[model samples]
Target: MTATQPAAEAPETAGETFDSLNPATDEVVGTYPVHTREEVEAAVERAREAARWWASLGFDGRAERLRRWKGVLTRRLAQLCTVVRDETGKPVADAQLESVLGIEHIAWAGKHARKVLGKQRRASGLLMANQAATVEYQPLGVVGVIGPWNYPVFTPLGSITYALAAGNAVVFKPSEYTPGVGKWLVEAFEQVVPEAPVLQLITGFGETGAALTKAGVDKIAFTGSTATGKKIMAAAAETLTPVVIEAGGKDPVLVDADADLDAAADATVWGAFSNSGQTCVGVERVYVHERVHDEFVAKVVEKSKDVRGGSDAAAQYGPMTMPSQLAVVRRHITDALARGGKALIGGVDAVGDRFAQPTVLVDVPEDSEAVREETFGPTVTIAKVRDMDEAVDKANATRYGLGSTVFSKRRGVELAQRLRTGMTAINAPLSFTGIASLPFGGVGDSGFGRIHGPEGLREFARSKAIARQRYTAPIALTTFTRKEKTDALVAKLITVLHGKR
Candidate 1:
């Protein structure tokens, strides 16, 4: 596709072809380019050359280019939003919001990359006082990013912006369902740096993602379901390439009895059904203090009924981006209901072809797969806990720890910190993505290696420490001249510093 054209289809150079079908209606939304191994290798080779030039620009020059790119996005905001809407089957407002967030991230990354990645002087130990030690971050040549269908813009930009600001060229393989969004981003970058393909796009299915992992890129950044993330890590291992996986999450939100029922209800509704519940950090489970459990559930049910999904203007959201996700969502809702669970809002039939209506299940057993696994649909399982301690225990029981939230007046921060996840927001859902300074990632099965903030900058660059002796010392142990006393002194210092009291 040309820069002037809407990225309705992936470029022909990528070779294979696939279709993006609307989940609401089983119609072909558009066709996408399927990249092969050969094309991926070529793209990586081109990115390597682009990386050198981009790196040579230094931090300041790159920041300027990034700023210009941001301006381009800001100017053509409408056009970009249209592509996102077309490719992902989301509402135009949702598309605009996603793009706006991506622009913010790019701006933040560009403005802060130098401060986060530049050289810094470090302290030399007393024994090595003569040595001047400094540490600097260097780029990792090229990065291959495999993005997911949900939150295509925000999710991929988390990696893309950081990698670009850190001086590495990126070859992004957006989810087949949202290639247009990916293409739009790359085209906008060309407005500021048109000399080379510093940021390129490749679209295909799992095979293409596999090709990218094995295509000799320095690192891989992937965002998808946990099962798929595991497969990606396994593939990356074959080449010994480092990877950052933003896998799926069964994120839970807890509400204490003292919390405001109205606020908790509002948060739960938006958190569970936003984007048709396709978010990686979307709230999939809820544990309310028994004191307010009944009130919270009724309020949430009432609020959810007002939230609708369709291809209309007043609808809160649009259809699901992918068709296959419908089956998974259905299976989970069914399993929960079959295990003596009750649906306060939607039941098994909520899974529609193009959109899964908001589903809030209660009385689901903890051991049920619906409770333990990730259900990346517009669904949630609400349960009551006797107190905060039980809520904490249940929240931390999951293997996946990505993000969590707490709605408590007195113990918000303390409770948030206790959760075994990379990030938690007090009385907010997915706020960490907005604060560009805080590290955003997951742990255990949720995946690792931050993609935003300082942690993100360091993730794309390697540390290079340099220590030089400013002057020769009197005790030159390495020279082997009169070193007996020096060796004894070194032994004594080690014993004094390291020995048990």
Candidate 2:
């Protein structure tokens, strides 16, 4: 049993299991099985068998099936949203947004797989002149995914959709906090691919996740915190399996002197509080040019005061999905205020039994824990910068390099690129999360490997370079032929063609 397990869980047991809960009220949402090593190995064996069938379909057939799966998701969106809200205690609208974004990724990956993963030519270099060269992406047998509680659909769907489009069978182990959301998605997928178990669900805690990483699956796609990502990578390394890690983010937004203050304020509030701030790419720090820091801070504070977490239409946010998170939230806020930070809007009282009210802080030291660490709550730290360069410096100072935003009327794109992060959006917040054509992942402690666009397709598939010579070359270098004279002649020819004048 892991920290997420209920208190009634038996002490130190194997093969025992339990149910997932509704975070809002602690009700049993669904029963889940804690698979043993034997069961996990068997699931891998089954997945391998299913992967072969799936890969045999090639791009066209797989794309067609994925299209139907998308249609299934589209038609039954409301029912899925209900499950998402129940499991995670997020607003239904937020759940719907995640579902819609996931649907877009599924459609995009399906529609674009062939172009992204199809065979292509490559230069083999002068040393291998006798060889013809090409490369193509191939399925990596089966892939396992360990997902997170926030954005349960969109986050894991980023890997699942791309993996399926790339022709790999997937075994998904969603966060214990949102197992029902995972099960619902898997069941819906089954309706489209009724003849196969291309997508399998295994439910449990960290042990289940560890089993997946250690399984014979060729790769693992993990989305969680940096601490757990390290553990997953270490486990996968036992099998020398490749892993894609979408870990935590202490992402920052830089507001330039020339930026739009109002848009930046709205983006900051939403980016910080959506999902009650459980997003990996959610904004945690704000570095504003001193010329407009006061105005920007005031505007964001005003907007944040209106956002509340509940199951109602007026609620723009939702409760903390995991109870233990309440403690972590409390700690980060307390440490920030202790270090001279001032809560412009919400404070310690904002965190309640269920929801964490949107909290905004300013006048915090740059080196404070709140500014440097990922709070993963509905909190944002505002800091002033002497100039845009200082703003970028402060934003890039953290260990996380996931998603970053820049609000610059004149320098948005340039600033976005300069930040040491995987994806950066200009003017708006988390726009990269909405675009299917852009690859989503991060570097440094945030994690490596990609989850969307061409990079995503390649991540799920392996490059199988096929080089079939059009005909035997007159000069054969691969065999023990009379090649002394041939080698001399070839060297001379190469010098004549390639020596710089």
Q: Give the top-scoring candidate (lDDT).
A: 2
Please, what are the lDDT tens digits per residue for candidate 1 over residues 1-501?
122332222235635578776655557767777888888888888888778888988999899999999999999999988777777778889888888988898999999999989999999987788899999999999999999877878889999999999999999999888877787788888768877678888888899999999999999999987788889899999989999998878899999988978988898898889888888787899999999999999999999988888887888988878777789889998899999999989888888778778889999999887799888889999999999999999999999999998999999998998998888988777788788788889998999999989999899999999999999876676674656788998889888878868
Model 1 weakest 10-residue run by lDDT: 1-10
| Stretches of candidate 2 exceeding 4 Å from the true structure | 1-15, 123-131
Clashing pairs in 2: none
Off by over 4 Å in 1: 1-15, 26-29, 492-501
- Clashes in candidate 2: how many? 0
lDDT string, candidate 2, 100-173, tens digits? 99999999999999999998889977666667899999999899989998889999999999999999988888
Q: Considering summed lDDT, which 10 consecutive residues are worst modelled in model 2?
A: 3-12
Instruction: Assess each prediction's global lDDT (C-alpha) against the native.
Output: 0.87, 0.88
How big is the positional error of residue 102 in model 1, measured in Å on the Cα after superposition? 1.0
